[model samples]
Target: MAAANDLRRGMAIKYNGNAAIVLEVHHRTPGNLRAFVQAIIRYINTGKSADVRFGSTDKVELVDIERKQLEFSYKDHNGYHFMDPETYDTVTLQENLIGEGRDYLVENLSVQVLYAEGKPVQIEMPASVNLKVVESAEGLRGDTASNVTKPAKLETGKTI
Candidate 1:
């Protein structure tokens, strides 16, 4: 069991019969009342999301989440595949489940895979990924002093 104050961003928790990730949290204080924690929760099962608030008097259970560092191997019609460096075990992560971070994925890049109840739930990439600029214009005018930039496509099919 854990208190509402224990909540944090990216911390996994249980809500309304499913797993949820803590997106944002804020504490509110009033004149008479003490304080409360307001949170934005995203449901992992159905992709339906919502916001929830937990008062100081409210107590909830804190789930233990385990993350492993693995390398992204490849992708296909099946899904994005990741391989464990130590065990050589491979797991497929669905595209839909990757949400908005799909464009940042690259081959053989290390990612943290979150597992709950022995089931793979989330793949976390670095805040910023280093990708080679694959489709940028040749050059504005040689490598001289140029103070302008233009649209470019990264090697991972993402626009930079």
Candidate 2:
């Protein structure tokens, strides 16, 4: 157990008998009222989010979390597959859990997957990824105007 005041973003905790990941936290104190902790948490199983408040001295049950570096293998109708580099074991994740991160996914890209109580809960993406530009229109000659932009299709099928 840990004090609510120690809560931080990305921490996993058991709230109301459900495992949730803390998305945000703020410590607020009114002029004359007791200080409290405000937090936004997302439930792991239902993918639902809720705002919760706790007193500064409140005790919160902290759940153990594990992170693993996995390499993206491929995606098919079976969902997204990843491989553990050390053990050579493949793990499949659902599309909803991946969310917008799918746009940046590329074969063999390394990413961090977080697990709480032995269940996968979140995916951590790298700050930047290099992708091949599969399609782009040729710029007009002498059109060297500043701030010029064009649509580009990446190898992952994402258009920018």
Q: Which candidate is the best by TM-score?
A: 2
TM-score of each: 0.77, 0.79
lDDT (C-alpha, whole model) for all candidates = 0.81, 0.93
Clashing pairs in 1: none
Best by lDDT: 2
Please provide, for model 1 over 2-91, each residue's C-alpha lDDT reduced to its tens digit, 9 standing for 90 to 100.
788888877788886788877778888988988999998777666566889899778877667899998988989999998999999998
- lDDT tens per residue, model 2, 41-75: 98998889999999999999999999999999999
Minimal lDDT window, size 10, model 1:
138-147
* Model 2 global lDDT (CA atoms, 0 to 1): 0.93
Per-prediction RMSD in angstroms? 3.3, 2.9
